[model samples]
Target chain A: MRIEANTRRGQPVTIYVDGTPVQAYTGETVAPALLASGRRAWRVTPWGEPRGLFCGIGICFDCTATVNGVPYVRTCQTPVAEGMVIETERPLERDQ
Target chain B: MNPEPVHTDIAVVGAGPAGLSAAVAAAVAGASVTVIDAYSQPGGQYFRQPNPAVDPDPQEPRPRAGRELRHKAEAAGVRFLNRTVVWGAFEDLRLAAYREDTAQAIELQADAIILAPGTYERVAAFPGWTLPGVITTGAAQTLLKEQRLLPGQRIILAGTGPLQLVTAAALVKAGAQVVAVLEGASPGEAILRQPGQTLAAVWGQSTRLKEGWQSWRTLKKAGVPYHRGWGIIAAEGKDSLQAVRIARLDRQWRPIPGTERRLEADTLCLNYGFTPATELAQLFGVQLHWRPAQGGFVPRRDEQMQTNVPGLFIVGDGAGVGGAELAMVEGQIAGLAAARQVLGDSTLTRRIEALQPALRREQRFQQFYARLFTPGPGLDELAAGDTPICRCEGVSKATIVQTIHAGADTMHAVKAVTRCGMGNCQGRVCGPLVAAILAQETGQSPERVGQFRARTPIFPVPLTAFTVLTTEGAESAESRN
Candidate 1:
């Protein structure tokens, strides 16, 4: 069952990783593009855990990455658009 | 602030068959492993009911194999962290997880990670699907396995799949008076149509099904009727499920005249199929194929269970639903493959060959089951105007249909307008039902609606749980260096 395939390859987009600029495709997520681009690590170490994606579905929040300075953007759900810079810093929630 | 850089060679999330197998294999190869899970036990959802203290029926006999596996995992030198909720994963091997009732973070730096998160039940839509007494077959099993509780004494196990029979057998064994096992598919159709696949499956699950069939036969001997060509038409109840109306169907499965029957029961068990729990895989950016066989949108992994992403692997139901034994083999294969990858061993051809037969057998068995229990007729049509498609926010079928007619072409538009999938349960309950409805309304194929668009914040986090973000916060300087 072929659904609508409105996608084409090599459509460039910008993804910021921990505030660093990384080029990506227009219809991909930050984490997979990061790994595909040879960036194995998404964040710095604190506890000795190998984290990437686990439950590819959203039930488990294992794939949450920061996007455009917004914290907890699920990398799996966030598709890339041109010039969309994503941030991957560990967010510290301030008391409101 | 408590800041520390906890480092490890491998961080295995989930303590189920896949996670335990991966952790044990990696640890055997000298990697420090930390296995975390929401449950306080090693077995994720499938191998549930391990702790005998929480036995399904204290008076009834227990299964010996489960007890053995729990013992083996406990002695395998794998660090098991139970009751741990891994809320999110940050880059650099850092994980934001809460444990022991405290919202502290845990950072894991590891060389490799294996994802063995299991699958959850997919409940499709129909009338009274959201009523108090209508629960998933998996949820019923979980209640029995985890807390040793039955929903009611007289229950109607109405749905497709081998689980309908299995759950009936379990309920009967647990002392619930199973009135009838109404399967959506015809029993003898496969014997006439797909004899080859049918025979192969019968051979593989002979022992297991024989046990189930024996229990079912025992229930039948005790006067419990098992109907094959029947489907539920209506679930009648005021505040809960009080009675269920069932009807016999013709070949194409429309209801036959004068065949309608009503049975009094408190609980109705329903499960159309399962969906691959792929949120984390999507997060990791692993490539996914819309595999109806794998329960939809599973990561594209090779025979060795390696995902498209390097050093990141997935197995078990999260990879795709292949039942318990297949998951175990896949887990072992993924563990071995990950270990060999870490060790730089190029000779994995022989290892993969040894694992091929079991995988093939499991796939064949699953294919047989998938063909056997196709959804019953009139279920999707049973959706009344007021029937709730989205249980989380209580969106009705009329609302979704009207929105689609009003120019909501994609699932994204429908979700945005109705807020159906934007609930705490994370659309595990409503997503598939809505997709099917959209497909039916738009004259689109189920596969077309199968590509349901996912928006951000896929998980529903209660607003009260978060204290509004402020700029001032303590730094994790000590943990950083």
Candidate 2:
């Protein structure tokens, strides 16, 4: 559950996560928005372990998720857009 | 398929305080300046401004030092390429950067290049550190400062340096319950024993001293226990962070046998200070020297922030782990020096001369802080054999030790054999840990273990972005055949 820390609000937008509509803000990154919605696990490893948002920066890439059909997009770096589709546990093909 | 190289008088690789200052100074000196940063915003980590859409109090006046520098640089006609990642440094000081918005690779050639990539938080490997709720202090601050998001309901800020206190205060203000602050150094020793040095360090920096005092007062008023000479030995969690095992440390920072205590915490913010981000400098073949006091291997820079390479300059945390204040001073000096070289302007010398005193004072404070917050020896022993040291590859400490025992003497060799530093991070997170492990096992100095040689594409770029280069190479090979 993401706590409301302040009173400032951006234009509320809806982004689909795993085909489920998740509410997000216009200026927030996808990672924080997902965390705010209580979806902490962005990706599941091949070993079935869940990982998400380790560094909170682009460097770690742990927060990577499939966004708008593109796999391994760093959710922390990618800002949320209205109607953006995000998938959490899509397996990255070797060629991709 | 090669992209046309963008030419600039001065190319600043980072938009942090150091890079921003350098770009502004050079632009003010009538030189064409281009500043590039991976972040969409101008401020580096230290001045991470909030995104208006996410920030509840978007109009709240936070620190504007970084914003002011960025604005000044922009006003001086300095070009800023935000959300661009510099992936490689090539011959003649050329840089290859990937633009995130366009997914295109661009080359930049500059008369002079300033590298100020800043630093990354150094985290010691402990059990359960890879858990979901375990994060670096910088990560916590980024969440709070940028997103106004608290890490967890119950958080424990454990680390050394003034950053812990500052982060704890921020977390408290943000309404997170800061259970306690575990500092590795003895507060009395750091404050009382070195009273003269502490006073001298803060002598000219009243604002900084006041900030520190205010943070301390905040924590004190909150009734949060600030344990001195204590450190986290392990974090106990199954899926995410539920608790952390902390212990009292001796002078050498070794944990006392019977002093272990477990604290219930939903989040564990681990920060042992920062390590210089030297991938670009290392890629450029700039010389690096190990200065343990300055937080490990850093690029060697002269007084003017110029590296051994004539046109290559490094400042900020990229050169060393000096804070933003020193980074600004160094950046100004470097910018002035670079401008003098490229524009043949000697008038900038007076400005550079004027910054020397402030630079010296900041340096003095940095040295004192470094000495006071040196990571304890016990931190080296925190990673058990099964603990994951390289989070990128999920390589365990045992695997690294096994690789070492199997005759992989150097870090490069170990990486080659175990793929410890070959993950998405490209050794940024595991490089220091592996080096420390190698040093401990082989009895070789960290310098002797050596850092991983950074290859082209320092940051991971999309494979599709490289299709043009690959096609060109294929075409050339077909023509030769």
Candidate 3:
């Protein structure tokens, strides 16, 4: 759900989330792009509860996802780059 | 493993209004200033600008003003360490900072430190609040302003402060169908009852009055229902938000029975106001006093705005709940004061004195909000037994209540017992709500319940961030560990 700001002069960039390519702009961050791609819940808690974007600010780690092989990075605070790989933290299937 | 740390006359944490002004004032007065901010840009929350690597947002005035302030700071020779976090403040004003992008770690040794970490939205817990698509009022604004994205199609805003109105209007303008705005207080009626104080508060606050009026008019023009004395009692959804249950409130913000109504919405933004991010201050052992309306417990400061910790100053909403204007005034005063402390320049007193009138006006405006929009006492008791109290740890209200009833009534004791504040958020998400609930659950004063104790690396940092940057410690780090 992105309204065309049409204010973007920054070149287009694509970042991959869970192996799916998400189109974004240079100024965009990982979380918004993921939201734009219609993915509401970024993480599935150990209790199998869904959580995403609680505090848009970086303080809350509800938005934590793996970025470029780094685990538990706050997606809201992390900017997007071409070929950037992100994976949302999830409960193990066995646990589920 | 030994290396020379960066030395500066003053290290101002957070580059928002307070930090920017302080950096500029101190630097202009010939103090070597270094500003470390988490955002890539200079604006803190107040003057939040989009990422500067892209085209500037022409639609907003904040970006332009922020650019000018940042330019002034730069011209005054303030060095910026943007996109960096000051995770820990060590002995002797040593700040442990890390840049996530570059994985650069810097131990900044400053003669004086100005803390303007700013405020974050305070979450009042309710049922289904932990569900996805339920976000804070600030989150909605950040999504629109920063990323130019709608958080949801059908949005419902609920909260006490004027930020709810502003966010609602902004959402409407952004083409989102903002269903309704729920204000817990009837401020308009409240104003009529106390005209003189309201008039005094709004007299010199023409800009704010104009802004709030414009937002109100925007909502009215869009035919959005503005419900006064009403607030959201619960968000309804399975995995994500599908709707919200809102209700009219009594004077103490307790929901009136049979007044409950549900609205279908994909997004529910709730804000009770903001709480100062006092982790760093608390980590420094600065004494904090409670002013429930002024963002909970704020650091005790002197006439010069310096805390009991010498050379340490806390200003802006981070210090308390004052708005941007007050932050700038306090920033300017503290900046000059810190500059004077370090540079041994006594001539900055006049400049500091000149900020008084602006400070007074902004403080008066803050008082007005405290009188008008402070959430009713009933808000602190909204979370039911199964309601998630700590969003991060997924700790239920029952767990917290049981822990309290088991003689662990204090915040620290509750945290230690139930692991409420032990998640990645480090209590930022659950601190205020838990503390207030602890106070209520025990019928004790806030002082007796106590705030969370902050530890080193107050913000969660990656072990790799340490290893990737400070390799000296990275190698000896694992070995030493």
Question: Which candidate number has the best TM-score?
Answer: 3
lDDT of each residue in B1-481, candidate 2, tens digit only: 4555789999999998899989988999999999999998888988788885544233433346667777799899999998999877766667778889878777778999999999888888988888888888887888888877787888998889889999998888778899999999875677787888889987788777787898899999999999989999888776677899999999888899999999999888888988888888877777789898888888887889898888899999878887888998999999999999999988878888999999999999889878888886678888999988877778999999999999999988999999998988888888888998999999998778888877667898876555434222222111221
How does each model score on TM-score? 0.75, 0.94, 0.95
Ranking by lDDT: 3, 2, 1
Candidate 2 regions with alpha-carbon error over 4 angstroms: A1-5, A90-96, B54-62, B467-481
Worst 10 residues of 3 chain B by lDDT: B472-481
For residue B64, give model 3's deviation from the true position in Å: 1.1
Off by over 4 Å in 3: A93-96, B57-59, B464-481
On DockQ, the leading prediction is 3
What's each prediction's clash count? 28, 1, 1
lDDT of 3 by residue, A1-95 (tens): 87775645357898988898889888888888889889898888888898888788788889988889888888898888999999888889324
Q: Which stretches of candidate 1 lie above 4 Å from their native place?
A: A1-96, B1-5, B50-64, B92-94, B100-102, B250-254, B345-352, B376-378, B451-481
B223-342: candidate 1 lDDT, tens digit per residue: 778898887877877555678888987655566889999999877888666787776666556788877766877889987888777777888878887777777788778777776777
Superposition error at B25 for model 3 (Å): 0.6
DockQ of 2: 0.58
A best-first ranking of the candidates according to their DockQ comes to 3, 2, 1
